[model samples]
Target: MEFDYVIVGGGSAGCVMAARLAENPRLKICLVEAGGSGRQLAIRMPLGVAGTVPAFPFFRFANWAYETEPQAGLNGRRGYQPRGRCLGGSSAINAMLYTRGHPSDYDGWAARGCTGWGWEDVLPWFRFSERNERGTDAYHGFSGVLQVGDQKQPRSMSKAFIAAAREAGYPLNDDFNGRVQEGVGLYQVTQFFDGKKRGERCSVAAAYLHPRLDWPNLHVITHAHATRILFENSRATGLEFRRNGTNRIVKARAEVILCAGVFGSPQLLKLSGIGPADELSRHGIPVLSNVPQVGENLQDHVDFVMNFRTSSTESVGYGFRGGWRLATEAVKWWRTGEGLCATPAAEAGGFLKSHPELDVPDLQLHFTVGIVDDHSRKFHPGYGYSAHVCVLRPHSRGSVMLGSADAADAPRIDPRFLSDERDALTLIRGAEILQTIMRASTMAPYDKGEIHGQDRMRGAELMDAIRSRADTIYHPVGTCRMGSDAVSVVDPMLRLRGAENVRIVDASVMPSLIGGNTNAPTVMIAEKIAGEMKYNL
Candidate 1:
């Protein structure tokens, strides 16, 4: 098969690239995904996140809930890394928080020599992609594919979280995406509130790809597992993939863009002989380019969650009152398109400085109405609320390595979480801040008692709890750093350093992880790259 552009891994970035590229009728685009179309009920329902986030082998859809290599920093525990494997990617499985990290994040990229990536430079791309429910503002767009709106009915606990934050002396800012990012408030979600899809999840595929499926210039191929990039010398010519039992090759006449995400992208490159040479030789794979940094610089938010069981049914859970409420809410969701199932359980969050003197916040907070133990993999009998505090810009870094040369094998992922002492220290201090907020009068009524990390509120014990239970909050990036140097896998233009005609438009290309949930930034990256491909490049 031959196409002008072959887009691999029909995730968020791939969907955006295909849709935008297809606008030009002359360019035929083929988008291939290893997963199914992201039209499952679980992916469309806001609360179906419970069903999708757990992902494959157990739940069988949406998520690729892979685990990390045992980490010495986390007391030898393997961390869970759940990525969306469907068309919408993690946007279908995430909390729907629509956050753009402090503008300084993008400006930092520009300062580091990535020329067109300053906050002022990329703001338009963000606006071009978002349709905020509150309408267009300096920071948001009202006419775009992605819908950004408020939750239909957030739980009382979520509101109380904001009150509790204020009671703890933090200022209240309605928009985290606005001028100042530091403060506490309810997050603006990427959910729909109008038309037939009202109260549903607005994943990137739902926003960008589904509507364009019938376009004559676009071809979406699902359930096609990418094996490797087919290269002509150092330039990526196309890719080889398997569907059912047959391996097929799709030739790219113009370019091949990899949107297979952090793990998938790097793994595909290495399998195709474009990674660390010494490591490739060990796996018996021929060295094509000997790029030492193909899978290096893995960064993620080192998250620590604290759960609290509440005495009231205002929170989400499964006791008698809670069960009745849930059943009634299901009916309400079906009847009027409002209630528990209509909202992502994590309805509120904030960004805060670990130290008051810092210019920008280094810690991000998520307030969920349900008790999230082990990513909701483990459950309890009662209703409760939970709060999460993650070191947004972690000092620690890790890597994604090959388990073997075979394309079917899972990559040897090692997030090396909490390996940096600075990360641990910031997280430890953030935990203290969370405890202080929980102690506020506004949070007292809902507090039955602590569940996880109970009584471990002090110095060494708090550190121990973090190490023993800390895991990723699912934002992973930098496995293919885009920089202005030789070691960087991609250039500022997002073009692969050693390979021509190959561009990467996923979170993996971030030189550093942003200070909030990664979905929005990842989408922005795709939009900016596609815009350049059409208007600038």
Candidate 2:
């Protein structure tokens, strides 16, 4: 098969690229996904996330479910890394929180040799990709493909969380994506609020791909596992993939874009002989570009949760009462599109400084009206709630390496979470801050004491708790970093450094981790790249 563009991984970025590039009738685009059909009913339903994303059966099936190599930083524990396998990618199975990250995050990238990635330059791309229910302003767009809206109706515990944060001296800011982000309020979700898809999870496939499926120029191929990029003399010309137990090759007339995300992108690059010289030589693969930075600089937000028992049955948890309530709430979601099912476990959060002297908020807090143990693997009986605290920008970095030469094997992932002493200290302090909010007057009514750690576990013991329990908050980036530096994998234009007709537009290209959720920023990257490609073509 041949096409003008062969986009690998029909995730967040590929969906947008296919939709945008297909606007030109003469251009042909093919989007390939290694997972199942993206039209799962559970994936579209907001409440189904509890089952699809957290539960073991569906979680492993819907996600790549890649675990990191044992890390010395976390007392030799392997971190869980789950990437979305379906068409929308992680956006389909995620919490659906729509965060554009701090404006300064992009500015910091630009300051660090990533030209045209400053806040002002990327803000328009964000605005252009959003169709916020709150209406358009200088910061948002109304006619965009992606749906951004407020939560249908926050649970009572979620409202209490906001009040508790305010009682703890934090301000109440309704819009985190607006002028300022340092406050506590309900999170806006990437959920549709209009037309036939009202109240559904607005995944990238639903927002971009599904809506444009009728376009003759676009072809979406599912269950196509891309094994390697077919290169000819340092130029990416096509891709070799496996589908239904058969090997297939497809040529790219123009470009081969890897939207396979942080892990998959770097893994594919290295598998195709494009990584460090030493690693490729060890694997016995002929070197192509010898790009040392292909899989380096892995970064993720390491989160530590503080759980507390709650007297109210309003919080999400196990028990006959909670189950019955959830059943009734599910009906309400089906009939009226407003209830617990309509919102995520993380209804509200806050961004604050670990130390008052810090220039920007160093800590990001996620408040859940439920107990989340081991990524919801274990359920606690009765009523309980959790508040997760994580460092906004961790100092530690890790890498992704080839586990084997075989394309079907998972890569060796080492996030090395909290390896840096500074990251551990900041998270330790951040957990203390979360404890303060839980003890505030407003929260005293529901607070039933600690469920995870003890107050006596101070200093060394507390640091031990962080090390023992700290895990990924699910935002991973910086693997295939984009910059103007010599060692950078991708240039500021998002094109591969030494490879021709190849570009990577995904979370992997982020020069650094953003201050908030990565879904919105990832879409912005695709939108900006699509705009550029339109003019270039």
Candidate 3:
């Protein structure tokens, strides 16, 4: 089989590319996904997000479930890194938060030699992809493929958190993606509010791929794990893959674009003999290009959670009583699409600066209405809630390397959490701010005091607690960072530095970590690059 463009990984970016490229009926496109169709009811129901937690069956089925190499900075604990394997990729399992980071983030990228990535350059692409329910504005679009809307019914505790944040002296900015980001408020999600699928998550698969599957030029192949890119003298010609316990090869007539995301994209490049020479030689793979930085400069947002028990059962928790209530909510959601099942656990959050003088917010806070311990692995008996804090622009960097030569083996992921002393200190300050917000007048009624790290733990003890409990908030990028520098793997245009007819269009191409969730930024990257591809063609 052959096509004009072969996209590896039917993820957020891949779906966007497929939908856009398919616009020209003459160009054939095939999107290969490693997982299934991602049509489970748990994936569609907004409140079913809890079912996608670390050890659940739904998570195992639809997620890569990659665990990090023991982080020395975290006192030797392995961090969990779950990437969605199904159609919409991580968007299928993410919190559905629709954040575009800060405008300065893109400006910083442009300043770093990544041309055409400044705030003014990328904002149009962001708006072009968004069909916001809040109506069109300079910052938002109204008639686009992807949907952005406010939560239909947020938890009462979530509203209280917003009030509590305002009481803590932070401004109540209703839109973080608008003029300001330094404030506390409810987050808009990537869910659509069309007259039909109201409150349904507008995953890239639903927004872009599902609606256009009938396009004669678009071919979607699920359960097709890309093993390696078949290159002819540094020019990617096709991809060899494994499907249904059988090996197969599909050629790309014009180009091969990789949208496999941070972990998969770098691993695929290394497997195809396009990474560091020494690493390739060690694995007995013939080297086609010696791009030493293929898997280096890994970055992520590491966070620590402060749990609090509440006497009110309004918080989501498990018990005989909670189970009955969950059943009732499930029925309500099925019937009218309004209940606990209609909202993500993180109903509200904010971006703030740990230091007062910083131009952009350096810390991100997520207020969860439900008690969460180890990504919901450890269940607490009664009602409770949590305040999570993370240093947004961490100074620490890590790498993703080949575990072995085998393509099926998971890549060795080491985020090196808290490697920088400044990151640790910033998180400590963020935690202090979170504590103050939780104790504010708005939360005083439901605040039953700290349940995890008690208020008594001071400087040294507090730092120790943070080091032991800190884990990734699941935003990883920069392995194959885009830049004009010689050491960068991809150029500013996202073309592989040493390979032809091959482009990397995923989070891995991000030169640095953004200050917010990575999903929206990932989509914007695809929207921007897909336009570039069409222009070049």
- What are the TM-scores, per candidate, against the unseen true structure? 0.98, 0.97, 0.98
Model-by-model lDDT, in order? 0.88, 0.87, 0.88
Query: Candidate 3: misplaced stretches above 4 Å?
Result: none
Give the TM-score comparing model 1 with the true structure, all chains together: 0.98
- 1-537: candidate 3 lDDT, tens digit per residue: 999999999989999999999988889999999998877777777766777756487458778889999988888999888888889998888889999899999999999999999999999999999999898898999878898999888878888988998888888878989988999889999886765666677788989998889989999999999999999887899999999899899999988999998999999999999999999999999999999999999999999898888887767878998899988988887777678877888989999988789999998989887877888778788888888999899999999999988889999999988889889899899888887888888887888867775444668888888888889888999999999888889998898999899999999999999999999999999999999878878
Q: How close is candidate 2 to the true structure, as a TM-score?
A: 0.97
Candidate 1 structure quality by residue, lDDT tens digits, 139-175:
8898898999987687788888999999888889898
Q: By how many angstroms RMSD does model 2 differ from the true structure? A: 1.4
lDDT of 3: 0.88
Q: What overall lDDT, based on C-alpha atoms, would model 2 receive against the true structure?
A: 0.87
Clashes of 2: 0
Clashing pairs in 1: none
Per-residue lDDT over 321-434 for candidate 2, one digit per residue giving the tens place of the 0 to 100 score: 889999898787777777777777788898888888877888888988788777776777898888888888999999999999988899999998877889988999988778
What does the lDDT come to for candidate 1? 0.88
| Positional deviation of residue 90's Cα in model 2 after best superposition, in angstroms | 0.4
In candidate 1 the C-alpha lDDT for residue 59 amounts to 51
Clashes of each: 0, 0, 0
